[model samples]
Target chain A: MSPDLLLCLLAGLLVGCGVHLLLARSVVRALLGFLLLGNGINLLFVVAAGPRGRPPIVGLGEESQPMADPLPQAMSLTAIVITLAMTGFVLALAHRSWQLSRSDVVEDDPEDARIGLRAIENDMSESDFHGGVDADPRHVDPDEAPPGTVPEEDDGSDPDPDAAPVGSAPGEGAEPGVPGSDDAEAGLDADRPDHVDPDPSTPEPPARRPGQEGAL
Target chain B: MSGEMLHTVLTALVPLPVLLPLVGAGIALVVRTRTRLQRAVSVTTMSLVLVIAITLLWGADTQGRLLVTVGGWLPPQGITLVVDRLAALMVLVAVTVTFAVLLYAIGQGRGAMDRESGGNAPVPIFHPTLLVLLSGVSTTFISGDLFHLYVGFEMLLAASFVLLTLGATIDRVRAGISYVFVSLASSSVFLMALAMIYAATGTVNMAQLSVRLAELEPATALVLQVLLLTGFAVKAAVFPMSGWLPDAYPTAPAPVTAVFAGLLTKVGVYAILRTQTLLFPASPLPDLLLWASLLTMLVGILGAVAQDDIKRLLSFTLVSHIGYMLFGVALASPAGLSASIYYVAHHITIQTTLFLVAGLIERRGGSTSMSRLGGMAAMSPGLAVLFLVPALNLGGIPPFSGFLGKVGLLQAGAEQPTPLVVALLVGSVLTSLLTLYAISRVWSRVFWRPPSVAPMTEDNRLERRYERRFALAPGVVAPTAALVLVGVALTVAAGPLLAVTDRAAAELLRPDGYVALVFGGGEVP
Candidate 1:
């Protein structure tokens, strides 16, 4: 029942190196780590199959000698195949990442990034009721704004409010010519005015109001 | 059929659930160019599997655990597929959900396929991969050997990697990378554990391990238990290991997200349940599991509260609810186990229904972001209703399966009323309240409020264009509604279902029946 020291050492080394590589940010490196880890486990499987013996072929070895357990070898073969398939899939994914963003370093989720920014700015308690009204005004378009409401630069302290709509113009202008864009935009435009009609009960707060930490 | 005849027939039917989908996947891949043929093959295969799963459930319930040895090989040596009530129930629920999701995906039509391929030549990868995933899931449920279970894990993981990153969009690719790495790491841990188990016991079969594992030194048994639990914990997205889920799942296309959200982690929970009950019946690590479950609940719900996107929010809640199952498992009582099994079945249907509804919301409003979505209640009352039932079901509202499952778990905890159990009870109740808050937040923002001007993000722009092309089809909505009804059905059928789960839990606690059945001579009667 004593496992081979050399084989155990090899498995340990492989697993150690594999884990180190897996923690890397690069997808390709992680793939390498996976392959190493797979091999390490495969080696561990070999060791776990018990002390080395004659090839597991029946009647090929002397009857008195013990045969190597064939089951771990079979299981490891399956593991090797799975590892190979996964490697191909990960490589394809890494390639796609490179194609899409010209980098293979896993990018942070945008929503997570936005949340992190909000945390850093100490603005985490913004109520869901504002309904994107308090979102960066840059997301809103000027022409879509109601006629009288369009010129509200009176607060003036935060430049982002008045400048947002002006900045949104070119983006909206470029989008209109695209097929199907109009129908989509029109549907939203119809909804936009209703959203903009300020709630008398909960008056629209000044754009970019300071974080109300306990708002929730 | 006579009782003995029925037993034989049922035992024979055991392998079909795994075999049929695989065969169907192969055929679907061959006929990939013909989308219609592929769809028919996929659906027909799953429908058959669904039928077989139902029969197996009946057989397992009446005739007791139906056992099949692959290639007619005997126990402790051959790969065994056992249909105990638990496995049969899992396979049945999983197949049902996957079948519905398949129909939903098909209803979505070419636009859905196009979204996956990013408008490239239609790859037809979806049907084949989904079938393979189904087969993998069945394999895990029925597998009676640890190595076979690992193979099943790899099969589903491989297929899921393809589904999750189907379009190769930057966001999906980013998410897929992390997902693939985490999954691979866990699989490695599982494989390592298998190695140690085999080395310690000289066999991988569950029946034999149930006997041999107890004879090992306490330290050796504890090491093996910790290793196996660690691997499953990662797969289950237990608190510390859960960071990858919200990031990865939200980026997939909606049906893909729905199925993954519903079934994948539950599969991990199933494995943990099976092992803890059968192989390590007197688990040395229930305290560890109890703590893990508590944190998984609290941390996951808090994370859900912070998410603005509907899919991401659901993803966090998915992680949170896995704790409930673990909570039941940790209690190590028949009632606890029964409640966990019921909760797993309930959560699978409810979670999938909600995600499908989220998909509907995305289509109707052109975004899943709570900020960008609003007025869905006014715009589409039917869609609002579709979203509401499942939302309340998930929030543990009275008369829903969610509430039933939680009440069962809490009642089980109260049986002991130890200090730790008391804390878990409080934590779980708190978690349920927070879940309601988060779900209600989604309901009001996405359905009730006035529509906001969504930012012109490139992703949603493309989404809107596709949404315009395929205006909310009945095909998509019907399957989602059907799944919603399925969740409601679980609530309605609670009496019989709980009876089945209680019987399953009783069998799980006593491994003698399983071990004897597996090793007892070939004649099932």
Candidate 2:
């Protein structure tokens, strides 16, 4: 029946609506819902605390009725300011996310999660885990290759625990070319770098692997 | 010469602890552009608070109890802040921990702060919000009225929302939302309980409640106790009500997590301790608290065991250790109260040190998961050593303060000589063993294993951007070293600290000392 109570109920309903929206998985909508919810709560404080009193002026005598509790009003003002600041910050973040991934919906970091799961599963599949056969494009067979011949991709796999990568590796796993052999060989033959084509005379592998899908 | 003058002055100091930060927060908000100025303000505000806490502690010890009625209103007429032995002790512990964490935050740089606030640079708002939260915490501990306590909780929670999700990322926001929503709900429950108590009794003053409790029927009192306890249990992260804690705490930035780890939940514990003794005295609630503490301990340590993430594991550990404080309080004896207070203090430093070191672990190792991180020892031996001290302290190894606190609690438990004691003692040992195991796992994965990945020569770009903005770095060696030294210092200085706690506890168990101080008149009983 009271106006303040009615306002409080309306604010409460808005808060409920906000909560419903927040529960949705869409990030932008959720952000909007949070904004609405915070506003609703701020409104409720105003209603619940009743209208602000003749502002608590020290030493002022002539005030009409029992002034409203200034505490809740002050609290509401503080809350509104904080919520606004938070909203602005959140919008910026949302905008950045949109720029980075082109959506406001939260995407699953499947790669990171899958990597985690893979690490856990490594113990169960040690035989397969170490095989590196998954796709070691630069892996040269140690038994067949000459000694001290470097693998093109270090791929950060430890050959020896103590050996630090001496600028020969850039991408955790990529090994730089052997130091002296390349430029000398490059200067001798303008057409070839020694690291890339050790034996140019050796015929290139067939363009298509035998029995591969859609092979020519 | 005059008792009234002393009471008035002591009461005035109560709001200062909280007001200073709030004023500082307002100033920080205005001067948001100047980062250095904000830092200066924040450091100065917190230092003032630290000094206030020390002075208040000395005053409370000397003057008995101090009461500050806001706006010069009398008790039950307006909000009253009361400083008693228990509350003063809490303030001391919180100040000490906050001081250490702030220093560590500064040393660690903007990177750490940025990580804490998500990706935002360390803004002036952080210092303001953090100070505001600390003031809330200090007031919550010392508040004489239940509603004032609720206000304190809200202050801390609102500030924490900003602290937890400073950068406002999706995950941090989600976590912050949960943290705030759950806390707000608990606060609502607390308010309802307060209303019910006021309806039942004519007053909300804690000391007055104690005297008035006996006149009320047992059932109504029990209902009030349970309702109030449940609300605080949510805050304390007690076993059944603690589901939200694990999900939210680990997701925050490290310094926030460290302080949250160190102090926030303990406020809930302090409330429970205050209520059980004052409002629901001689009830079955002690047994309930005992069971709750026991279950919380077992459940928390077990939860820690299941988590692979370092932060998550530590969060569980934080939950589990709360049981020790609850157990001490549940005993409802002088010795039990003192033991709980001492344990609460010791645990604050230890838990914070552990979490900060966890930050250092994340910094050096690049990930928090044990399996992915290896051989940090070779890269940062200082960090490795830093991790060792807190880890060992948490494990309750001897020659450390953690062991002393546990021993004190165990002694308190034994004094009761009941089945509850046996249960608590067993839980204590088992939890300690599990915690030790968890620490060892961190060490072996982080320190002992061969370097699996080459050290990162350049900082991660994302990490750098965060640092450039916030200056949040895990300046591990200094803050970690300082906290470690504090832990060791606690170990060495246990004699005097425990002595003070014992005296404080004795005063708390005898309510006359507090009541006389608060009402500013003769003994009530």
Candidate 3:
């Protein structure tokens, strides 16, 4: 049971554990784990190069025998610098993520999730259309927007007899005329009205008939 | 002159490709004003490097082999630079294409493209990073040892990560993160492979490894070979391990994608060629390599067939063409290796051209999706003509470089007198036709039809005039000129290039030539 052998085993164990933890959910824990892993490798490098020697920096012209290998120590120093920089960057990223989303659990980006869902729905509809089975839940009528607000042009062209009341974000099958055209504010606001929220709100339709909802 | 002095001078050359761009990049980075000056300096530096690389190639060809050991130490103790024919040729081609692309980037005018694309201006760091990347590729091709190869790979990877995520758009970010992760993972595997080879043979020097590897027990040697291949396969984007490339290549900024599509995977192919020829010639891996390449060819083309997006389809084609290069290497014959080398040079130019032109498509037609794009030919006849030439060449149309390269490979396969060779030949031909079909489909849909949706928006900023006489030059003209010229050169100079490739093939097949140069005493026989 040589001490050097035990040291190597411990370092290897630390690296394995550190890597495992680094892959976990908690950012702070991952950073700590990375530090431990780096230290573990540095220790392993020193031991593997050999043990029981004086430190490498020479003092005066003193007689030297079995000086410790300087290369591994140098490598460790570089590794430490790199690790420090990486850790700082990772911390910044974590902070930014928290500020943006208030959590660091690494959730799916909303827009990207929309795209992925679109792709999946496309696939589902494609298969259902081909298989001649029940219709896919994602099958939007060609004339309508895909479960979102319809464009203004669509609203103008396809007038809805039972449309929602005026003074709202343009919805599917709205009236043909400009809303509040007779009001003096129409000329005042050539662009979007000042009062309107940039992000349009879609009033959630009260629970629909299950059969109609599922028909998509 | 003393040998040490000459060696020092030569070693100085080893760092030239790497340092010059960094020097230029530093200038570009700090100099905030006078964008024109920055462009001039970057272009001048790159042009100088291209010239130097060409001269070096000439010297290498005439002088047998060029070895430059850094810091004056020799053998297993110091980093070495060995410029054999293959390395010299790689540096020459890489320098040529990189310089051309840089010119195109400058000529195309980032201001215009950014305005047209309705985006924030592109960072000037793009050119600097690209130049830095070329430096890495040049060194990777010339480095004499595995460790240096690993460093070169890292240098390239880091630059490529920056390139891939250039705009940091959401899509680009997602793609870039996956790309960086997969690449770094492969690199870690490469590092482990290096360690294993060093441990097994007690040497990492390519020259020394070449001689000592023969002495290793078959099993240990086999393990090292397989590990090395796996590491390279990830980089080479070989089938089954190549999932990352299709996602990554298309999402990058155009010029960046062009160079990456052009040179990066070829570096991996170069590594595989070098290692298999030098370190593991008798390892019984050639048969397996042939089969893998055959599958790569088939699977890659099929993947291309299934893709609707222009970039993804081209990416699949890029993956598939790698099989032909591997085919040449797997044959273990001079013709095969030489053809592969030639094909690599051709493929780099062709693939870069393809991706560059694809960028033009995105620029002129708006979206890269075939469904969204059409009537490019009617709008920009020059761009249409430019795209047609490369597209046909990519499909292995006669007299084009692709045809010549494929013919050379098929000839080598024919000489093998084995069923595997037959399959390789048939597979090569079939893939060529399938690829042609895909290219034609893209051509008809994108170039030959009326605009599918709305006409491309007018953005004068993106267009660059090539000449006063032709002042109405298409927006794609400057961006695609370099690639188009490369395609033309490949077609016109096919004879001379193939001859050079033949010589290279001969050198690779006969281990004696390479080993003798590396060992450097006299003839082994």
Candidate 4:
């Protein structure tokens, strides 16, 4: 059966507008988007029920005139209730967000943001960094390499000798000269050089560094 | 009892799993002010449901599928709840996990309440909401109609939104917004898919659709399949759609995160499994599933490897292992499907146990960050053991059920021996190895290394005070240890469990039994 073109077009319009709003960063907009999206789908349900007919009452409609399918209407009613409940819930969440952070925008996950920043600094893919793929062989110490196998470009002529030493010492500290040291320092104990010395007898501190937790 | 009476009795038991928790949820909500009574009511309700699920499992195993028409209305016109082997097994495992997590949440809640001395009495909403979530999950498992399944998803999603933001802490609020939006988006997609399906087939009943969907043109069927899979994949946290999971899950209280991590996504996987097997048996998208599985595995594990927080790490692994189940489903063979089913059950228990263990780690170590946590093994050897067993199980160590499930999937892949299957087999092993690496990294950093000296700061001081207030409770530890034992139990029972899953897979791959039973007047054949 051919679907109702006008209803279909209306549903399409609502869905298109709904998705556009859903992509916005603001929670209120997303909630509105959800409402519109839900209503669009509900309309689709109506359209799917086929050609319109008299109210699906048992005795009100004549036998010659077919009644609308009641099933989709029932289903759409359920959908409306659920959508209303969720809209209320999301509204509450948006209010909570405003109360907590004084903003209604969805915040980027701190860890994700940090990782993205590191990826840019390192000029590498985020997955490569996460996968522990070291792009530059120079980050590997020349001393650790076999005697004859050092790259031809590596003549130990680099201006920064300390860079070599930092790269050579395992777990001493992240290389400050490296572009992604911000990530390394935040991730490892590189920022707190005192942590480099493993003092077994030191009492456990009551507090960790503020803001270092990064969304834990 | 005579055969007829037995059938009647078993049919009567089918609805209890969904009904009991809902009724309990109502009672718990009424008694919300009395924390003790709420706990008791919730626990009792779940226990009773657990018993009913076990009986249903036995009945379904012995007597073909058990069907129940809601309100005594016949199918294609009424809501149907069918407990074939697949649904029964899923319900049983789901109830078991929810029950244990509830115990852990209760223990944790009690500890928090005691320390605060009623100043921060546990939010009474947790009990009722959790019960509602359990009911929603059970409804999804037993639902015989597509729209009913959609309702089940909404019930659970609404309940979860409440549970996730229980305390409405800033971090949780932030997390909950993203979670709610993503869930709503997926639910809309699912609703749209249902609308389309109804438009095509003129019915929402699965049994009727099973017969009717087969007659539709191939292209139409593929569109429906893709739409359905898209919705379920987001819920399941399959790749490209999985980014929200790690971000959203880690910020909640441990028990909330534990249940969400364990059961919520599995519900999505269960829907995918149900639809794939019963509605679209001749899936045109196995290749798509295979590619998705491979990407999910690789991408999810890589994310896990980079994570410093144990909760986020476990969340990523949860997404990664979903690939293994998808792999089994993609194979579309009995061995493959059976192995996938076994893996789902195995992964649910293992993943939940690990999250519970992470909670324990947080309680004892004062943080779940691998950087901040250390020497937990030395400080709390019992907690260490609890963490180690599940960690090993999750990493697919030999003799664990994880290994067994992977072996089954691999062997199934071997049977197909197609290039894509071969690629998946290799990818599966790689994912497993990478998983082990990620897990071991967490183990060494969080458990073995010397405790780091955290810098003294006001935030840290407040956190320490909070930690001291809710000092580790034996009540909490016991439930976690119990769940860890449950994971081991999966290992010990792997043999018989595989047998059940094998039969379940056979039934899933062959949908005629289901269609027949659902339409055949709820009768035992």
The candidate that wins on TM-score is 1
Worst 10 residues of 3 chain B by lDDT: B461-470
Candidate 1 regions exceeding 4 Å error are: A124-216, B116-118, B121-123, B454-470, B521-525
Root-mean-square deviation (CA) per prediction: 10.9, 12.6, 12.0, 11.9
Identify the runs in model 4 with alpha carbons over 4 angstroms from their true place: A119-216, B110-122, B454-471, B521-525
Model 3 clash pairs are: B112-B461
Per-residue lDDT of model 3, residues B1-525, tens digit only: 776665556546756776787788778766524566777778788888887787666666655567766777766656777877788888888987787677656644453222211233245676678877987887788887887787788778777877776644434555654565557546645655665565466567787787788888988888888888888899999988887788888866667778888899999999999999878777748788998899999999987876657888899999999999999989878888888988999899888888887876664444576644555676566667878998889899998989989998998888887988898899999999999988987887678754433222342111111000011223235547667887879879888777777777676666656666655665322
* lDDT winner: 1
Task: Give per-residue CA lDDT, model 1, range B218-287, as digits (tens).
Answer: 8999999999999999999998999989999998888889999988999999999999999999664778
Q: How many clashing pairs per prediction, in order?
A: 0, 22, 1, 0
lDDT (Cα, 0-100) at B357 in candidate 3:
79
Give the per-residue lDDT of model 2 (tens digit) for B42-83.
Answer: 778888888888878878878877777778776655667777
Q: Model 4 TM-score?
A: 0.86
Q: Model 2, residue B17: what's the lDDT?
A: 79
* Best model per DockQ: 1
Off by over 4 Å in 2: A1-216, B1-11, B115-122, B454-476, B522-525
**TM-score of chain A, all candidates:** 0.62, 0.52, 0.50, 0.55
Best of the two (1, 4) by DockQ: 1
Task: Give the Å error, residue B267, model 1.
Answer: 0.4
True contacts kept of each: 0.26, 0.00, 0.00, 0.21
Better of 1 and 4 by TM-score: 1
